[model samples]
Structure formats: C-alpha cells, structure tokens
Target: MIQPSNKNRIVYLDVLRVLAMLMVIMVHVGDAYLFNAETMTFETEASLFAVLLRSSVPLFIIMSSILLLPIKKDNTSFFKRRFTRVVIPFLIWSIIYVFLPIPNEIAFGGPANTFTDSGLNVFLYNLMMVPFNFTGSNVHFWFLYIILGLYLFMPIISPWIKTASKRSLIFFLSMWGITLFFPYLRLYFPQIHGECDWNDFGMFYYFGGYLGYVILGYFLHHHNRLKAGQSMAIGAILFIVGVIVTYWGFIHDQNAFFKTLALSHVENWKLIEFNISFLSPNVVIMTAGVFMLFQNIKLSAFMKRVFTELSVFSYGIFLVHYIITLWITAWLHNSMMINPGLEQFLLTVLTFSISYGIVKPISFFPRSNYIIG
Candidate 1:
C-alpha cells in the first residue's frame, strides 16, 4: 500500500493533472468543430476524440479523491485551505463569466454581439442562481459546484476512510458500480419507478455518484497491490474496452435518433451528448485505467519540469481555457478550411498555451493565488 504524504507532492498526480486539463481542452475543441461539421466523416472523427476525452473530468475527480480522502489534517485547516484555493476563484470566475459576452457564433450561430445591453441584470441573476444551479454564465463551471459538494462530504467521509478495511472498501465500491448502471436501467425499464429506498433508508444513496470515484481513488492509492506490469496490462484492456463502448454507443444513439425522429444531422448529434457524461460506465473505466497507468510511470527531469509548470497553473487554465478555446475555435471557423481533427488539435494547443501564458503572469502578482489557484 502506498500512502501519500500531505507535505510532499506526488509526481504522478501532477502528471495526471496536466494530462487531464489537456484532455478537457481537447474535448472542448472537438465540440466546437464536431457540432458544426458539414461532413459525416469529420463528425465521426471528432466524436471519437470527444468520447475518448470524456474521462478528463473523471480523472480530475479521482485525483482530488486520492489527495483529500486520507484526512491527516483537521477540519478547520481543510475548510480554510479549500475555501481560499477553490471557492474564492470559483466566485471570481463566475462573476467574470456572467459579464463576459458569449460569442454570437457560438451562442446563436450568427454574427457576434456583446452583452453590454443586459450585462448587469445577467450578472445579478447568475449570482442569485449560482447557489442552486450549476449552469452559471459558463456551462463548464458546473465542475466547480460538483467539487464543492464533494468537499462538503470529505470531512464526513474521511474519518471512516482512514480506518476502512479492504473488504469494507470493496463493498462500497461494488455498490457504487451497481449504481452506475442505474441510468441505463431507467432508460430501458421506464416502469421501474421507486427509488432504491427501504422505508426512508437511503441504502444505495451513500454509495453512489461521484463519491464512488472518490473512494475508488483512495482504494487504488492506498490499497492497490498490483505490480507495474499487471497495472499496465489491466489498464490497456480497460482503456480499449472503454473506447469501444463510448465510440460505438454514441454512434448507435446518433443513428437511432436520426432514423426514429428524422432529425437533422446537428439535432441527432445533440441527442448523444449525454453519452459523454462522467457517470457513464465507459468513462469510469477509462478514468480508472488512465489513473492506474499514470500511477506506474516514473518521470524524467525534463518531463517533471514540464508537468510541474503545467500542474501549477492547471486551475487557472481550467477556469480560463474555455474562453480561449471558444475564441480560437470561432476564429478557425471563420478562417480557411482545415481538417477537423487537425483544427481540434491546434485549438487545444493554442488554448492551453494562451491560457497558461495569461495565468503565468497573473500568478506572479501578490495575492493573485486567491483568484487563480
């Protein structure tokens, strides 16, 4: 079993953070081009990339679990650190997004327009709605709300995790796995109406949702006994299976929706958007495999430096990268034609680079960490 020290940073976790953030950008790039594609071939290629990158957010969740589940610190310190690091920036970014104009091409698929007319009202309304809603000005900020909810439960769950036996952890994970299938169950068996409740007892409630990823991270980090070779083999198989499931699932759904509803190509594409949810079994599997693969990697000095720099600015990049991605994608959309795959790759790179550049300067200012970190 490997236990992470609170004082010492884990190199593999840093690598995972860098990779995950890049994947997040990749998915956004793919979305920009794929949704607007005029050719089935381009859409198909982009969809494959998007599905493969769906594990990006799950990786972030799992990495958070690995770092926070051990609970070696007190609640006061934990809350204070998390608040300054996460909550404050989330609020700042939420406000920024509220006033920031949505590109009209991206917003209404027409000429661009600024939000100056009703920006104040929009900001106030978003501020009011943020507490109860995840769809603040930026759709991607839903992650902030989810992570906050997870943090709320961290203190409550950490104590149990500290002393949890392997069997107990396995039981929790098994229940979590069962809950992952609930979406499909509901889809196929609409008549199954009752909740998994036994006279007000939330039997499956405690063992489900993103909490499963949390516990899974802790289990893999603390209790996993597999060798590097074994991990590599398992990771490869799981990753391949996840790719097949996601790619084929989306394709199947898109075709079915087109045939059944006789919808346009873009409308059919939207129908399978839910296929990329983090709760999907394929995404979970891919996230686990990728996490395990990184766990077994030993970084060289050059790679370590690069990963560390990117990891340090990862939070800021995540908060700001969407804007960069959208602008670059819009520019590309208006510019000369290029291959969708290449456009996505270029957009992702540019977004990451520009966001990193912007954050790096801001990070040097006094107390800027509160806004960016």
Candidate 2:
C-alpha cells in the first residue's frame, strides 16, 4: 500500500484531489436534476450515479492522512496550522453563505438551500449553530466538521500508527471493515453488540467512521509493496466491484422518486443513507480501489504544475462551486434542450472551471489561504 513518490512531489495525490473535486461537482449536478425534475425516471436513475462519487470526501480525508500522519509537527503546531489552513477559511465562507441572499431566490429559480436569506433572526441562528452543525444550510459544508474531527484525532492515533506492525494494522482495518457493514447489519438487528439508546458503544465502536480511512490511507501509503501495474490491476478489480455493488445496492433499494450531494429530494432517505453512506463497506472499497489506481498516475511536467495548482485551489473551489452550480443548473434546465446526462457533464465542467477562475486569483491575495483554503 506504500505510495511511490516522484521528484519533489507526489503527483498522484494531486491527481486524486482533482478527480475527487470533479466527482463532488458531478454529485451536486446529479442532485440538481434529481430534485428539480417532476418525476423519478430519468432524474432518479441519474442521481443514483452519484453513488460512484460518494468516495469524494473519503478521498480528501485519505489524502490528508497520507500527507499529515506520523505527526511531523507538534500537536499545537499541527492544530494551529490546520486552524489557519482549514477552519478559518471554512468559517469565512460559511458566514458568507449564511449572509448571502442567493438561496432566497435563485436568479433562474432552483434550490433555496443554497444560502440563507430568510431574515436577520434565521441568519443569526444559522451562524450561531455553525459551531455545532450545518443544519438548515448548505449540506456540503458538513465535510468541514468531519475533517476537523479527523484532524483533532490525528495526534491521538499517530503514535499507534508509527509503531504498529503490519499485523496490527491489518487487525485494525479488519475491525474497521466490520464496522463498515454496521449500516447493513443494523437493517436486521438495530442494537448489535451493545449499541442501544443508553450505550452507543458497539463491538467495533472505536474502529468505525472516517478514522478507518485515515489508518487505511496511512497503511497504503507506507505498507503496500506491489508494483504499479499490479496495484492498478488490483485497484481496478476492487473499484469495479465496488462500483457494481454501490450502484446496484443503492438502485435496488430505491424506487420512489425523490435526490444530492443533499438527499432531501429522495422520499426514502433511509434506503439512500443505508446503501450509500460514505462510511459503508462498498464505498470504502471503492475509495481504496480508485485511490490505488490514482497512485500510479503518469503526469507531464506542465500537467504536474497544473494539477498542483488545482489541488491548492480545490478546497476553495469546493466551498464556492455549489452556488455557481445551482445557478448553472437552473439556467441550463430552463434554457437548454439537452439530455440530462449531457447537461450534467457540461454543468460539472463549467462550474468547476468557473470556480477555479474565481479561486486562483483570490488565492494570491495577502493571507488569502485563510480565506480561500
């Protein structure tokens, strides 16, 4: 699972970050069609496509782990750097989203959850609650919470990861893998292995969630010894199997029309949550697969520079692209007579490019990483 490095840079990770960003946009684009459509036929099938992209956040987390694990800096420095790099930018944008009136009325008419323009009281409430959750606002902002938590937990686990043997990691991943199936397990038994209202600890309680991905990424980055061709082959198999399972499972459980990156449009959100949760086994498998595939990417010098720039702007692009995507989706749906699939493609392209254009310049301003990161 050890990641190979090229001269002075890890270009494959850069490529993965860019791919994840595009996948995220595609997820949002699929959401636009699913929620806006009058019925579920085309829109629902298309939205189901987002299951393939569910690994986007996991990819981001894994990339973070690969770069930050082993705790090169002290906890204080790590946290301080993370705070400036992520939390500050997140707050600025979140505040911007809360105050912006874009959600009140899409210029072309679409989703209002884009931003909060309800009133002073509602905006304040959302702002105040921002410290706690991302309720009644942009759902994508939820990534910030998960990432922040992972960052906090990083130092706690770093020592264990550094000293742990291969068997130790394997055991941890096995337990974590068991937790991945907890979503399906709960379908048959609600309180499995001591998980109940009074006591939330299950058999693999500590091994669940995105932390597994952190360790998984660490293990892969430092432990795997396979050649590029072999790794890619295995990655392809895993990714293909993952895609099949993810798509079929989500589609099988889904019949009623509903849809996102927000599943508010889906009438049966429980099914959506169960099969496509980012923490599920299938998604994790898919994440591991594509991540492995990306590890062996070949990049030209110019392209390497380009991917690096895109990676740097990726976080800001993520925060700002949603609004632009909403606008683009509404305009495309209202003005264009095109296939939903084609529209989604164009929507992802245009939104991603436009967001990059906006972020690249702002990223150069003084202390802008805090604002744009």
Candidate 3:
C-alpha cells in the first residue's frame, strides 16, 4: 500500500499526472485534425483547437516536475537513479527514433535544419548533438537532458531551496527572472545569447518549470495544512479561472477589463506571451489549478484502479506513445483517406490501444520497467 505523509507522498500528484498524460494524448490527437488539408491554416476551426490544446505540453512538464521533486536522494544517487530511469530511456528512444525515422519526425515535425544523406551515421552524430542542443536535433529528448542537469544541480540547489527563508525565496525569484529575461536578450540583445551559459535548466523555460514543480513539491511534502477538500476547492476555482482566461484570450480574443490585468506582464506592461513553455505566470496559475484538482478530488473505484495501472505505465506510455501518434498519422495519410471523422476516431482508438497494450508486455523485460514508469 502507498504510504501517506504530510509533506511527502501525495496521491493527488499521481492523479494530476495521469490526467496530464491523457491531456497530452488528447492534444496530439487534436493535432491530427490539423494534418487535414482543409484545416492546415491558422484560420481554420480545427487549427484553433490545436493551438488551444498546446497547454497539454506545459501541463506535462509541470506535473512531471511536481511528481519528480519529492524523490529526494543525495546528488550522486539521484543522478545515478534518474539517469538510469529518465535519461537512459531518452537516449535509447533518441537513437531508435533517429535510425528508424518512424515516429519522431512526424511527431516533432522533422529536424529544425538540414537532413543529411547518410541515414544511420548521421543519426549517431545527431545523438552526439544531445549535450549542446545547438542543432535542436533530439527535440523532445532535450527535455530529459535538461531535467537531468537540474537533478545534478539539485544537491546544491536543494539545500538553498529547503532553507525556507527570505534569501532562498530571493534565490528562486532571481532564477525565475533570468529565465524570463534571457529569451528577450536573445531577441533584442543577440550578443548575450553567445556569452550566456547554457546548462541543462539554463534553457530558462525548463528552469522555470524545474523550479516551480520542485518548490511546489517541497511545499507539498513539508506542509499538510490543507485537507483534501480544501485542495479540491482551490483546484476547482483555479481550473475555472484558467479556462475562462484561456478561452477569453484564445477563442474570443477579447480581453475583458479584468482579464487584461490577469495577463502576464512586467511592471512596465511589456506583455508576457509564449512564456508558458518557459514557466510564465499563467503556468503557475494553471499549475495551482491542476495541483488542487488532484489533491482535492478522489476517484471512483474503477477509475482509481485504472489510474493506478495507467500511472504505472505512464513512463513507457510517454516514451513510445508518440510513435503511435506518428504511425496513426501516417496510416491516415496513406490508407485511411476516406471519411475524415471515422479515420480520426479509429486512428485515436488504435493508437491508444496499441500503445497502452504493448506497455505491459514490453515492461516485462529486465530493467525495462523503469523506462516508462
């Protein structure tokens, strides 16, 4: 049985995680709607839906940080374990996806720059590109690298983080500030990009996420002042507010007087756009909402059992599921051309079934369970 603690293990984190994973899957499925010739442009109804669903990615990152944070260990031990778990799978999949070119290209939309004639060899070189991320070759797997870097620094960072003092809070806020400002530096002050250090979380966006979830995780593990009911109420309110804000901004494109202030901005009112990926204020808002929902809510027996199982498979599900999405997209483009509605429905069903189904059997292999879980 899973043990509960005031500041430690929280069931709601897992619940939020499972929900976030499903949202990611749903976002990808919704993305398929875009591949349709009629819906390729920004103006189309389906395209707008795709844009709205982009929150799923940020949600996944936020949830991952929140869940992964409480797994406290020494720096060396933490690195060893996380490397064996998150990084190893990322590397293996990075290679497989590179050689096969089956799923990654489709899911992430090809290499950002040049593709070479040498297939396997070029991919190996691309794997070497992992550390720097200059070429942006390993795309999604870059997150694993970045997160691993954060984990490495956690030994030093954690002590400061745990201090629970004003100075520590300043440390975190300062980190958040640099993260927010760096991208702007790249845009307006191009020279800074060359001089600035590029560690794993140094990417700013990932750093913010790393900080947010880690802090939240620490807070959750250290404090249990709120009961489940309280968490749920807060979560519900946050979710409702988030929905209203997202819908107001994206769909209606009208900033109601109050909503305008709700938008992220510095003191001078230079608007914060596209910062969710980098841990914008909106992300913090949504994170609170998601966190509350998971903490406050209890699942029914059926859902509880299923979520338990699903959460077990989430790692593997995350790893190879995109491959399923890619193949589904391919199948639709190749064979399932008739009836877009049916094609989409069947494609989603088949993708989920195959991905989820394969996870268990594949997980049976030695040391494999860590890959997805």
Candidate 4:
C-alpha cells in the first residue's frame, strides 16, 4: 500500500489509473485492425468499435486531473516532476518508435526506414511550436503538454474549484458549454469563432476535463462521496446502451460529417477521421459512461494489487504501446492469413496482450525503473 501522505489515499484512484491504461490499450488495438489504413481490410470493419474506443483518451485526461490536482506542489516543482517523469520518457520512447521498423522490415527486403521515414522530424519540430499545437505522431505525448499547462495554472484555478459553491459550478459549466459547443455552434453562426471562447484557446477540452474531474475528485475525496455499487450499476447500463446506439450510427451513416451528427457518445471515433472529431451527443454520453465507470467501480484485491504494480508502468506503456501494437498488427497481417472478422478480433487481442506483456516485463528492468515508475 502507498504510505500516508499529505494527499488523500483513494485506493480506487489507482484502480482507475489501471482501467484507463487498459482502455487506452483496447482503443489502440481496436483502431489498428478496424480503422488503421494499413490493417483495415474490409469496408464494414470500422463499426461501433471506433465509437466506443473514443472514451479512452478523454478518460485518461480526466484521470490525470484527478490524480494531479490533489498534489501540493509549486509550478516549478510540477514541471520538474513531469519533465523527468513524463517529458523525458516521451522523448525516449518517441525516438524508439521512430527507429523500430528498420530492423524488422529490413530483413524482409522491405524499404529502408529512418526517423524522417517514421515522422520523427514532425515530432521533434513540435518541441518548438506554441503550446497546444502539435505536428506529428507525438502520438500520445500531447497529454503531457496539457498536464503541464494545467499544473502551471492550478494555483490560480484551484481556489475557485475548492469553494464548491453554486456560482463556481455554474462558471465551470458555462465554460464547458462554450468549449464543448463552440465548434458545432460555428456550423450555425459561422462567426461564433469571433466571439470570446475558451475553445479558441485550444486547451479547452483538456482544461475542461482536467478541471472537471479534479474538482469532482476533490469533492469526492473530501466527502467520501461515491457509492460504488449504485454508480457502477448505472454506469454499466449506460455504457452498454451507449455502445448499442453508437454501433447503429456507424452502420447506417457513411458521410463522416453526418456520422458525427449521428453518433457522438462513443469514445475513440476521433481516430476515424478529422471531421468526426467534434462533439456529438453520442460522443459525450459514451465518454461520460467511461468516466462514471472509472470513478465508481470497485476491484478485487488481487486485481487492485496487480494494478498497483502495473499502473506505475502506465505512462511508459502509453508512450510505447502504439508502436508495439502497430508492429504486431503488421506482423500478423503479413505472416498469417485469417478471415477478416476474426483477424480483426485476434489482432486486437494480440496487440494488447503482446504490448502489455512485453512492456510490463521490460518496465521492471532496473535501469528502466526510474523512467517508468
């Protein structure tokens, strides 16, 4: 067990972290065979799976807020922690991902590869870009920028959040409404972007989810506010229903634009295409279900203990898992032939199990311990 600290000990938060990590893995695995340009074999493959996977990233952002918001640290200290713990690992893993295919593909008489081939130039270029802007498969590293941004501004924001007054909640809800609604509002107003908007700031979703979950976490932590049983029951019901609706939307809709208007609640649909990235009712509902389940569920003691061990590696896993998943997908696609649907399902499982198995064990390497934990 983690020792007592100035921070509150919600054993559940660790469980949440582990769940978020698993969600991320599931999202990527589903993405690889279902929607990835290289692996997608059939037109009908990218169905409800993409929508449901959409919950992963937002849930991760919310989980970050919950975990970090309670900590008492200055901005400088926070940066130092992240720079060492997050930024450094991100850079190292990004470089590794950049170079991974050379050895594997070279032996098969495939094309040669390098950092530029893998888009590392774009990744490195973003180090100099303005905040909230990115240019490459910085892949999963974008969250670090959001986390750092929030950490810097937390001292200013936490005061209002802590008050827990109706006014504060209203202010936050208003911000959320404007940010979440701003882009779609553009479809009607066209000039809405000219108005003062938090979405214009680009950090809005990250800020909104961060602030929302953190403030919510603080209240829950302080008051012991959640009842796991009731919350889980409600969340599971909504999650399943959301999945069904999201599936129906994808099957019937062809235009990416109409689909966004159709299914908004599923989680990983952003990977489907750029136009579908905007807020839709389905997207919001499904993501809410993900957050609810994350916050409310209880885990077995054995599972919780396993999560405690693995959650330390969560950051590293996120950073490296994409490349690992991609490689596995490519290998399976090339080496063995399977039916499209089974291939998709097996690819998902193979990618998840292999990536986690490899990374989780490597995460225990003594030299890597400082980087992962």
Candidate 5:
C-alpha cells in the first residue's frame, strides 16, 4: 500500500510532479522543430523524441488525480480550496499572456507584431469565455479546462473510490481501455460515433476519458501490490511498446500524407495530426509504466531536496514557462545559427531555468502561493 509521511506528503509524487513539468517544457521545445519542419520527414530522431514527450500532459493529469481523488472533504470545501488554488493563478497568468508584449511571430506563427485592436478584442472575448474556451490566450491553458472538468467529478467519485475493491477498479479500467480505442476506431470507421452514450443515462461516461487515469492514479498509489522489480519490468515493457507505436504511427501518417499530396510542399505536413493522442492506449500504458517506475525509486537526499523545490514551484513554472520559452527561443533563433536539434535542447534548458528563477523568488512573497502554487 502507498503511504504518505506524517505530514501527509508523498515524496515520490513530488518527484513525479517535477519531472512532469520538465517534460512539458520538453514538449514545447520539441514543438519548435516538429511544427516547423521544412520537409515532410518523420524519420528524424528529434521527431521521435517529440512523440515520446506527448506523455507529459497525461502524466500531469494522473498526478493531479492521485493527489486529489482520495480527499474526504465535502464538495463545498473541496471546490473552495481547489478552485481557489488553480483558478486564481490561471486567471492571473491568462491575463498576463493576453497582454504580454511578445510578438506573434515568436509567441505564435503570425507576423512579427504585438496585438492589434482586433486581436486584443478577440483575446478579451476569449477570456470572457473562461473555463469553457481557454485556448485563445494560450494553448497550454487547455490543461486547466480538463483539470476543472475532472475536479467537478472528483467529489462524486471520491467516495466510490474509497470503498472500491480492486476487481471493481480493474473493471472500470478495462472499460476505460476500451474507450481509449475510440479515437482509432473513429479514424478507421468514421460512422461509429457517440459520446460515451451507453443507453441514454451515460452510465459508461463515468468510466471514460481521463477519468480512468485519475482512478488509475488512486489505484496504483493505494492498492498496488507489485514488487519493485515486477513494477519496473512491466513499466519498461509498456514504455517501449508505447514508443514504438507512437514512432511508427507518426511515420506512417507522414508518409501517407507525402504520397497523397506531392512531397514538394512544406505546407503539406500530414504528420501534424498523426501522433498518438494523449488519451491513446499507448500513452496510458506509457504513463502508468513511468509512474510505477518512479514509485519504486529511492531518491538521494540532494536529489530529494531539488525535486521538493521544483515541485513546490511547478504550478508557477507551468503558468510562466511558455512566455519564457517563446522569448528565449526567438532570441536564440535571431542571434545564433545552430542545428535545429541543438536549439530545441538549449531552449528547453534555458526556458526551464529562467522560468524557475522567476517563480522561486515570487514563491516567497505575501499571498504568492495563491498566484504561483
């Protein structure tokens, strides 16, 4: 069984949280290359690494569920605490990104200019639709919407999870496994369509989507009985399989696109939509495997301290990292002529370091935790 310390903190989870945040930076860094590829080629090692980084967001969701789903608090108290923690910081950062002077060429792929009157109005409109359509200001803000939706269901599911047996949890996971294939099923069979509509009551809806990862988090934390060796072995195998599937899937998609549309056009990048979804079965397995692998690690004192600090600032880092990424990547592109692969790697490091440097000091200010945590 999983156990927290007397203070109720799980150190391993802290490590996982830190790793997940770093992985998010990696994904954004990879985007600089993956999205801007000059040609339709998926055979590059950088592309494969980008595919591997797709697990980052799913891992974040899993970590959130593992920590939040076991709470015994009532819905009112839960919402009051959780919403305040996430939503306030979200709004603060959303507004910051909305007005930040970063040019669109760097921040996004538009012309090299700050917001125009029409752009500002559109940004404000999207902000006005908060908690529903958040992708307007920042694409990364989509995670907040998903988290908010999951939090809405947490109170209703918490009690059930507290009393749930292993078999029952397994059954739910199996149903979730089936739902993971829905994306691929739609790809091959476009006629099959429905939103978890089992009968009219949406009974299966409870067992679908990222909810499985949430429950998986709780289950793996509290109910896992696997030996350390066994867990690592299973995790390693799953991760390998996930990598193969993701790499091949994207390659196949890119080749098909190149063949269908002449390969001469850089604009005809078909591999853009071919990677495994975060909700794909491969990602689920990979995330579970990685989570389990980390669960069995014994961190050294120095490493533990580093992870603890990173975890504390992780939410803040997530909020601010994108701007740092855009600025740093733009500067690097303008000032230096380097390999795209090297640039991506350097951008990831610099973005994470600068973002952390900014957040670490802000974390000490009065009422800063509400903004950063």
Candidate 6:
C-alpha cells in the first residue's frame, strides 16, 4: 500500500503520495460526519465528498502499480522489501488495535464497538485471526489485504507487463471494465458469465478487481507525457463527471430507501453505499482523473522538501492515524465551536499532524521502520 523512499523518486509521485494519504485521512474524517448525521435520507458534506474521495485507495494502488510494476527484482527480494515495509508494520498495528480497549463510542460519538473482547484469552483469539481478517473497527485494513494481493500479483505479471504490447494491455483493461458492472448485474440476475453461488469465479473474474488498476498504472506510465494544462483540463472533466454520477446515484438510492425502508436500521446506509462501490466505473474514472491531475504537480523547493519527508512517513502516519480519528473528530464536532463545514478539514489536518508527530520519533529508533512503517 506504501512505497519506500527512492534515490530516483519522481517529484509528482512524492507529491501524489502525500495527497493520497491526506485524501485517505479526509475519507476517514468525513465518515465521522456521515455515520453520525441526523438523517440518512439526504446528502451531507460527507456523502457528497465520498463520491470524489472513493478514489483515495485506488490512487494508492495505481501509484503502487506505477512505481512497482515491471518488477525488476526477483520474487523473494521484492516480497522481502515490500512485506517488511507493509505487512510487518500492519501486523504491529493490528495487534495494537486488537488489544486496545475502546469501551466508548469514538466516531463522532457513534460506536465504541471496535474491541469488545478483553484479557489474554480474547486477545489470543483475535490475534489468531490477524492473518485472515480485520474487524469492522479497523475497516481501513481492508485496503491492506487488496494491496497484498496486488503485491503478490506484481511479480507474477511482471513478465507479461514487460512483453505485452500497449494494445494488449488495453485489451485486458477493457475486459476488466466489463467486470466493473458485475455488482449491478447481480441485482437483476443472481449470476452471470458462468457465475453462481458455488461458482464465484465468473468469466471475467480474472480480469477484474484491483488488477485492472495495476495494468492501467503500467500502461499510463508509458503514455506520452501530456502537457500539464491538457492533462489537468481533461482530468478535471472526468473527475467532475465521476463525482456527479456517484453523488446522483447516492442521493437517488437514499431517497428510495427512505420511501420503502424503516429508519431504525442505522447500518442501512450501506444499502445506499452500494452506489459508490469502489470497484464500479465511477470510481475508476475518478481514480484515473486523480492519477492524471497529480502527475503534473510542480512543487516549490521548500514545499517539496516538506512533502518528501511526508511522503516517507505517510505510511507510518496512516498506520497510527486511525487510532485517534474517531476520538478527535467527535470532540471537534461535539465542541460546537468550529464551523460545521470546517470540522472535517480541521480533523484531517489535526489527525495528520498527531499521527506524523507520533511516527516521526519512533522512526528514528533502530528497526523502527519495520515497526512504524
């Protein structure tokens, strides 16, 4: 999910790394508003923002693909370096979140239900599941799993990536694009393209999931470097259209749900979330928009140095930032002093600062990269 500092780091990649992490923080911060809002039938800032911010994780994936695909290193070497930077730190944080007791609601005073188990017996049981799953409390870790899969696939696909013509890669992406509509297809028919409950592997399953983004990243890497103005102009249109489709789908679904469904199910909002599924076409468009828009960034000297450091510690901050997110966002909103519009922005900045502060010092200790990454 994160890349290491490189001797040949591209400026925009570093800048994009910082923006991607910040966008991730924004997503979490916005969730505080969404899950705790008074009504589910209407759009809030969080819901509006979710349409655009769904691109956050995909951006990271594309960036990882752009940076790591056509993998030069052997499998063992690549896994050694990537897993050390990602999985070990992930495991460490998983343990911390598992054992740490949050006996009260934290997400804008939403739910304290992350870790209900206590003591060694409970901790051991949860620890045993670490290799398999993370609880809803640590939902962000889901990205970690997707990324690990991509990492595993990277070396295996490197040869294909190296040899495949641009046309061939585009063909793969086109096939994957068909799979993007599978979720909707499931609504009208339980199965499609040779898929069923038993046959989860459909005709295009091989071409779907995050793998397309990996191929896209590599293909786009070889694309002609468009002028900054041209790229941003086109990217902005795609980004706006993506946002409109996502938001429209969200609002339409929410209104329909309210008309037919009872209001008691707080989690019913997930039904509405179906519209914004990250695997869908809207997100893919937004992801491409972000990839294009960021590639042309030109940072000043001082800002570049600052972002370079941020880029290095971004993964570390991501690991620890969620710990304080709900708690801080709740306080900010419950305070009633900060502008409602600004709560999310302030929460993102504050959480980023706090997480960065915590990780920066730990990064100095020996072997801490393996721990704090």
Score each candidate by Cα lDDT. 0.77, 0.79, 0.56, 0.55, 0.74, 0.78
TM-score leader: 6
Which residue pairs collide in model 4, if any?
53-268, 54-267, 54-268, 55-267, 264-282, 264-283, 265-282, 265-283
Clashes of each: 0, 7, 5, 8, 0, 1
Per residue, candidate 3 scores C-alpha lDDT tens digits across 169-251 of 55665676566546545567654423544433333454454555555545544453578788778777866665555544443
Candidate 1 lDDT over 189-302, as tens digits, reads 643335543443344666668888889899888887899989888988888888898888887776766575576545654567556668878888888888878788887666
What's each prediction's TM-score? 0.87, 0.89, 0.69, 0.71, 0.86, 0.90
Clashing pairs in 1: none
- Best model number under lDDT: 2
Worst 10 residues of 4 by lDDT: 103-112
| Candidate 1 weakest ten by summed lDDT | 105-114
Q: Which residue segments of model 3 deviate by more than 4 Å?
A: 1-9, 35-40, 43-72, 101-107, 114-125, 134-138, 165-210, 220-224, 227-230, 247-278, 300-303, 333-350, 370-373
Error in Å for residue 318 of model 3: 0.9
Off-target runs (Cα >4 Å) in candidate 6 are 1-7, 37-43, 103-125, 259-269
| lDDT value, candidate 5, whole model | 0.74
Better of 1 and 4 by lDDT: 1
Per-residue lDDT tens digits of candidate 4, residues 94-205?
5554445521332211112234566666335444442334334444555566666666676676565656675665566556645655555666775543344534444454
What are the per-residue Cα lDDT tens digits for candidate 5 across 246-349?
A: 87887777667756674433344434554566777878888887888888888766666677777877899999998777667666752557766666777788
